[model samples]
Target: MFESLHQTQVIPDFDEDEVMLEDIEVEELHPTSTETEKNEWKKRKTRVRSDVWQEYTKVMVKEGDLPVERPKAKCNRCSRRIAADPNKHGTSPLWKYYTSCVKKHEANKSQTVLNSDESGSMINWKFNQDRYDCVKMYLTRKMHLRIFSVFPPAMCGTHLNLVVERGLEEIGMLVRRVREAVKWIMASPARSEAFKDTAKLYKVETSKFLCMDVPTRWNSTYLMLESALPYAPVMALFEIVNSAFVRDLKQKTHNKKSIGVPEELDWHEVRRKCGYLKKFHKLTEEVSATSYPTCHTFFKEMCSIFTVIRRMEGHEDEDIKRMSTRMKS
Candidate 1:
């Protein structure tokens, strides 16, 4: 295991006047050099603090009798020196040079990703668990370097789904009954066609064609409910018409548990629960429409979800109130 900061070996460009070197004592080597001469090359204060600084050392040269700092940044991994005038060009040259060095070093070592366009180049360097553990063990625990991690704001679809999942439990019975009813109708091509005929018979326009929910995503559950709710009357009549098929399903290979149809009470519960869920579904659609969504939009949607759930906490129904309160917690 490597202990100290890692450095790479790079070849120097003979054409350039700049070269890589470590600190050297002028007085010890050249007794004629005075203390005042040594003090002349005192290291200048770095105006900007950057991680790139860790890789390169400033070359100190002697002009006759005095040691002077050169306007150059040298790569530790290689002898290549870059022209770095902080006052004039800032650290731009140093950053660009380091980026190239990283690219070459990573490629030579068969490491994946990392190389340009300023900060964009650093995006691909995968900092997985091993690197994370090393930072914690050597840096933080050893107190050698203080590292602060800046995390991006949490507003992904995963976060939204997680937030909605608990609230869904409140109306699990209603969801299950509706899911079962939809599942029965959509079980086979024959049954699906029959359901479409029934929808026409009742003149109920099923938008998603009896789409069901995937267990992982709650938006699908909301969609499943959205499509199924409009066909409440259709489902009731269809269930009665196909009672024998449903009975046979239970006796045969289908789920042995009672695939109960959504009753009036279940439908009522679904309607009430859908009020908050619709907000999530709409926001989900808006967010999904764009490949990249702004954090401001996510912030507004998050606040909207919070408001809906908070309002539900004060709902007249005790079950809704309890569910909302639990979800808020």
Candidate 2:
């Protein structure tokens, strides 16, 4: 009975609740670790796909050695194949097809000539007072020709002939007719009023008193002067003549109307206007010095000014006629 020394120890049971309640803090500083790993995997997959695609593209290019089929172009009218080269044909599809049509259109175009019913009127005559003065000087002084040479032969003879032919009084009737035309043209709403007025006035006075018709006689006079001078002097003389004519017309009109006021009436007015006059004079002087080039430049400027003025005044028909007349004369 004394041999059995058995020790009875109490077995401690482990509590799950106590273990769960224990503060077991996990230090997870990198919270996106799983997401980062997923992104790296995706990148690797993308790289492999890109490499495969590039290799496929290279293989395709090497095998083909040509581009895909291009769109075909054909002419609508002829139903023919049209070339794509712009230099050989034209840029637009329509342009290449319409080339022959355009040429045909141009070929079919007609020439138009302006017509006027007004009698005793010469076309393209301008009142260049300066030109008139120069022509007068050239005729009377340089060429030793009478003013009669500068003017058309006495319409007196023509009038007498017409009177005889038509049985009409020639003397005062012609003058009266011309004067009426002058007044009518002066009062006209046309841009040609200036030119017509000057021409009519010249016809009236010159024909009535001097038995001359300079307006109709300018071409002959110009030719005679041209024939007499060297080319350079001829051009200079022409400009001078033209300028004098314009100046004369202006002067005569002023004198006739008794508008004797000087352009610079007041001192202040002169000062204000001087700047423009100075500029004009400077340009004129420069042109005058240059001779032929100046003439060409002036003529070009004049045509441009005339064009603008015509457009503004709505006198395209009159302007065209006047320009053509000038060229012909």
Candidate 3:
């Protein structure tokens, strides 16, 4: 048996602690020409835009906007081309320069007025800076800002206004109920305490009291609904506890106005309406931002609004569909 067995060296077994595993180096195989071509196409297909202009260009059409001159990028608002090559200008410098150009254009336009003669020839009537400044200063000193009230238009062919007004109309009953609930709680200290007690009873957290909404200000009404929704359960309980008070109040106002006490369904409606209106609310906030030019985004925003309205048209919820239809009108 020993002679038949092949001669072999005896291997000693090392302890587990003495054995160390070295990291294996991985080698990447060289890609074939076909794969390389495929990879190049994939990179092009999945290319991500890192610059603001690249992202903006997707939503912006070259039509209606000024075209950039060769070797430089032009701003849409001011039509100012970059002094240097846009590729080397980078993000910050390019955007800053463009905004500065817009401001400069705006300043020039403010001081410039057009005058026409009988022959229909036009001349640029420039205002004196000193005179303009003096007039502005005098107006600021003499005019009372409080007396000059600015009432924003409700419907001015804008999508924001369309949605907001329709949503408000749909939830008009719910709004009145919320307004009445707020009045009920605030009219008496006892009712207010009872309202807080009910919230405490239900272990509900409230950060603030219900806010009042101005009749003309729909934004404030949305805010009131937002604040009131959280305390809906508490308000419902308070209404039950003071049912007699509510009934007597209703009877007193029977001829003047109907103070409908909000029930569970009414509160739920308020919550739903708030959720529906939130999109318009957010749109308003975005468009009203003072930091950047919103006019450029008008077309994009209107498209988005129409898209939302179209989606809501087929919504499973009847209220949403109804609101969307009303907005369409």
Candidate 4:
């Protein structure tokens, strides 16, 4: 959304996550004329931006005021109009208005900005550190952090999911093949029974079926791989119990088609990937404690992630190295 504003209008560029502006109060929406832009702008929303408009409103003023017909932001509280030209300086002026001008604004706005929930409740949060620090300083003294205030140094659990998703993309084909294999097994009662029998033959636990991952949730994929890795040795034995699925993959491999079967190398890759992810999965579980502060523990988990990424960067596989490099960048 911010990128679109920068491309079409004279505004600063921001990542998709950066422009999540929060609206302070719900105001009447006077729809403006439609545009002819190539990109569909209506679909996009900027949520985190509400704080900027909490005390101001963007309104057009006459040409006589500034020699040019320029837009001005009218203070919602005081009805004072200020220059709002979409230029290099984006919303900095408007942000400075409140807390500095209105005495009530200072009283209403929190310096520490905990914005936290009831004690012991886990909730999703998002905030950039630079922005949070700047806002904190603007509202109060430097390093005047309130005791018990929790602010994560890294992305929160939900945002961390985006990073995990991208990393998972590095092994998308392998994941898909595993998913297909699971589907082939669980989609039929007979195949599932054969799987249990095969597991029994290999002395592998037949307590659970091969998990099929939910595409939207990364952890499901982790669970899927985690369960399937135990059956890696027995996978070749699946050819004996379930030759049809194996035969199909063999034919595809022979005919220059994409391999949709979990092979030895593929299982090896899954095991390694699962090892890396299992740590993060545990971190998320720990950080998910909402009743108490998890921020302190979060930093330690971040260190672990950094260490893991560095190790992955030095791995023998080029694919793993490529993935870690992307994650680092």
User: Per-prediction TM-score, please?
Assistant: 0.50, 0.14, 0.48, 0.51
lDDT of 4: 0.74
Ranking by lDDT: 4, 1, 3, 2
| RMSD (Cα, Å) of model 1 | 27.5
lDDT of 3 at 321: 84
Name the candidate that leads on lDDT.
4
Instruction: Give the per-residue lDDT of model 3 (tens digit) for 258-279.
Output: 7567788887777777776776
lDDT of 4 by residue, 109-149 (tens): 55554546768456787768999788867545543532213
Candidate 3: residue 220 lDDT (0-100): 81
Q: Where does the lowest 10-residue lDDT sum fall in candidate 1? A: 145-154
Cα displacement (Å) at residue 128, model 1 = 22
Please provide, for model 1 over 164-230, each residue's C-alpha lDDT reduced to its tens digit, 9 standing for 90 to 100: 7887876676787787777777779998887778778888764556787896788889888988889
Clashing pairs in 1: 8-77, 9-77, 9-78, 10-77, 10-78, 10-79
Candidate 2 ranges with C-alpha deviation above 4 Å? 1-68, 74-172, 175-329
Question: Candidate 4 at 49: error in angstroms?
Answer: 58
Residues 127-226 of candidate 2 have per-residue lDDT tens digits of 9999989986776567553333423324222332222222111122222223222333234355234443444533432222112223333222222222
For model 3, name the residue pairs that clash: none
Model 2 root mean square deviation, Cα atoms: 27.3
Report how far residue 133 has shifted in candidate 1, in Å: 22
Off by over 4 Å in 1: 1-156, 245-259, 287-292
